[model samples]
Target: MSLRGKRLFSVNCTLGLACLTLCCSVSPLFGQESSTSSSGRWLAPDALVTIAPAMEPGETFQGPVDLPLVLNNPDIAWDPHYAPKSDTLAEMGRDVVFRGEVYCLEFSFKPVRMIAVDIPSFTGVQRKNVWYLLYRVRYLGGDLRPQVEPDAFGNQVFATPQSVAAETISTPKRFFPVFRLQVKGIDREYPDEILPAAKRAIAARERVGQPLYDTVEIMKQSLPVTTAAGGHSLWGVATWVDVDPRTDFFAVLVQGLTNAQQLKMQGEQIEYLQKTLVLHFSRPGDTMDEMQDRIRYGIPALEDPQRQQYILDQFGVEKRLDHLWTYR
Candidate 1:
């Protein structure tokens, strides 16, 4: 769609976020007017995509939304041979499509990072220093199941209202997730490592008689992720939800909240959400000359071995990347 005459909707925002219409233009909406990089060039085949937020908008609790309130009693560690097995770099030079009534977002950066991994509590290969692009997810035409219910911990089950269990969810179907967990690259199905855990949990639930009646499938969903890729639109990337092997992430959220903050977030009106964007760039060290050199000469400046060493030597990787946060 041509964003020709549409004056961008502006609103109160902070950090890298700037408010824009929900169906915002794909143009670089929040960056400087300069069209080219310091080297005077634009990213090639740069794919602009929308990823559902980790949680809904609002500033009540910590983070986009606390993950612990969303996942399990126990978290699962990602497979050690996780990354390097796939391309975990910032996504660029690819095509992404999202169908059904959707919300569009654009960023003025190359290799836009898409991540959804919550460590210690939940795990599935993740990279260092990525910003989760928060967008609203919606399924076009299908049964919208309510993915929430009290868990063993007595807190909410999922982050967003109508979320789905990716492990058990069928593909070629559509869904907007609470948030899509960011990983290094396309995922491969691993063994059902959680079967033992689930069986034990189910037996315990049976003893309690409640049997975790509604969440059995979700628990079983701790199975492997499907390796399917390179297909039609929504099915490609927007199809799956992260598998919660033990719900460790969710457990943490429940324990971390102060009683007051917890009640208010689940019930009251908190800080306003103004459709904002969060920018997470690579560790600095790219001088204007370095950036210019790559753009002007078509050399892979950011990927150059020397620059890679410079970044590792400088910051050593984002221990706590503050740029991804809005408040906490």
Candidate 2:
């Protein structure tokens, strides 16, 4: 067998043994009951794929979703010297389809790394590092079931029990494979533009040595009571985009708050956001004026005394300003 095949076989053996051990330990009936009948069936190796934000010092994140695949390589070779005379080598490999929601837990300028390994033996065979993009991903498993066709009357239908078990048993393991993808080469648009602009604005303001305005307090007080509902929708859309796997979306959003504060300290963030709004939304050529107008009027509309307090209570001006004003 080739070196890669050998390594894969070894990993599969280790994983099978581990699974058997686990099954034996958990089931008391299997512990004392010995089966003299050897079925000659080999358990398949489990494949996993994982996505997440790049790791950072003092930060730890976990993903609940994991993509698992059962290997079904058919060209496996069995060495008589490595097994009993009657034993035959089992080959396994399979194509796995997976999808999930991803959130950014952290953001850094560092490179992202990914690794794929065979389980049980934990042998790493595939590795990649994305220099421009780093992500941590949690795999949310997908459901693959055959759908029943409707009759002429459009009646409901059911699948056979055997089909149900066949589908469910096909995806049993929860192993996660890690991968790092670089974002820089994927597009010509630089993702870092907004951040640096905000930084430069802050620096320029500080150089003038002028008194900074209390934009944080202004944002805090200007916060409308009904604005949170709209902001939540924005958050949901951002999460659905699967922008990056490694960072928590909530954390990134919070970072905007921090950036705002930093800009406030230097009297630049709000100004930059305002400038961005005017340049992008107020221009006669800009097509987004209608949306901007809605936002402008939406804030005051929620202030009506007849509205529910909960709607007003959840309003967040900082988030709105961040959305409407921030370049990013």
Cα lDDT computed for each candidate against the true fold? 0.26, 0.24
RMSDs, each prediction?
A: 26.6, 30.4
Candidate 2 per-residue lDDT, tens place, 182-293, comes to: 1221222212211222223332322212221121211222211112122100000011112233221111121221111111112211212211110000111222222222
Candidate 1 regions exceeding 4 Å error are 1-52, 56-160, 163-291, 295-310, 313-328
Relative to the unseen true structure, what is the C-alpha lDDT of residue 53 in candidate 2, on a scale of 0 to 100?
A: 25
- The candidate maximizing lDDT is 1
lDDT of 1: 0.26
lDDT at 88, model 1:
26
Across 174-231, the per-residue lDDT of candidate 1 in tens digits comes to 2211222222112322211223233343334223211221222332222121213211
